[model samples]
Target: MKSILLSVIIIIIISSSCVNKNNSVQDKEEIIAVLNQQQKDWSNNDLESFMDGYWKSDSLYFYSGKKLKSGWENTLNSYLKNYPDKSYSGTLKFTIAKISAITPDSYFVMGEYNLTREVGNATGTFMIIFKRIDGEWKIIADSSC
Candidate 1:
């Protein structure tokens, strides 16, 4: 009886570990999809749709260059001010460098962004913290350089 119980416990632990690993892969894929969608939206000049990947909360944070922006509205305002039209927004592209699980509910992602615009071309690197909230993966914090 004791050996049977021990074997069952070990099996349960292994199964749980496997499940967690699978969940991490699924979460990473979902987050990447969100990033891809953002790029598509930006290329289409749909600012509102691009912002959908971000956390829609007052506590959301974004840092670009030397500027620190707080809240979803502020971030949206900054994007609108910086890219007022398609000529400024341009065609966006992303190259993911890394995506790692920070926690079961959070992930850290680093990527490079390029914008082909009529005004000029722009390229930057960004690191983002994505958190699973309300059953959705949303970017909680972002830093672009």
Candidate 2:
């Protein structure tokens, strides 16, 4: 009887651990989905929607080239000024190279982006740090290469 009970408890523990692992994977997938939508919105030239992926608070930070930008609105305005419209935004494609959930509420992702259009094309790499707030993942700090 003792042996049987111990086996059952061990099995239960193993099953519970598996469930937790699966849940973690699902959470990571949700974050990835948010990032994917962000890319699509940018490609569609919807700066407003693209901005949705970012943390709306003043704590948001972004670095592009050699300049460091802060605030959500400032980032959006800069994007609009640089991209202007669909012609400049072009069709964007992102290939995610690495994505890791650093903690229950934090993630780090690295990806390469390409813009396609009649005029020209630009390609670069991006690294983003996301934090979960109010059950939603938002980019807290992002940098481009």
**Evaluated with TM-score, which candidate comes out highest?**
1
lDDT of 1 at 104: 92
Put down candidate 2 lDDT per residue, 26-126, tens digits, no spaces.
87798889978987998888989999999997889999989999999999999999899888999988888988878867889899989997669999999
Residue 41 of model 1: what lDDT? Answer: 98
Compared with the true structure, what per-residue lDDT tens digits does model 1 show for residues 1-145?
9999999999999999999989988998999999999999999999999999999999999999798899999999999999999999999999999999998999999999999999999999999999999999999999998
**Maximum-lDDT candidate:** 1
Each prediction's RMSD over C-alphas, in Å, is 1.1, 2.0
* lDDT of each candidate versus the true structure: 0.96, 0.90
What are the per-model numbers of colliding residue pairs? 0, 0
Runs of candidate 1 with Cα error greater than 4 angstroms are none
User: What residue runs in model 2 are displaced by over 4 Å at the alpha carbon?
Assistant: 1-13
Residue 86 local lDDT, model 1: 100
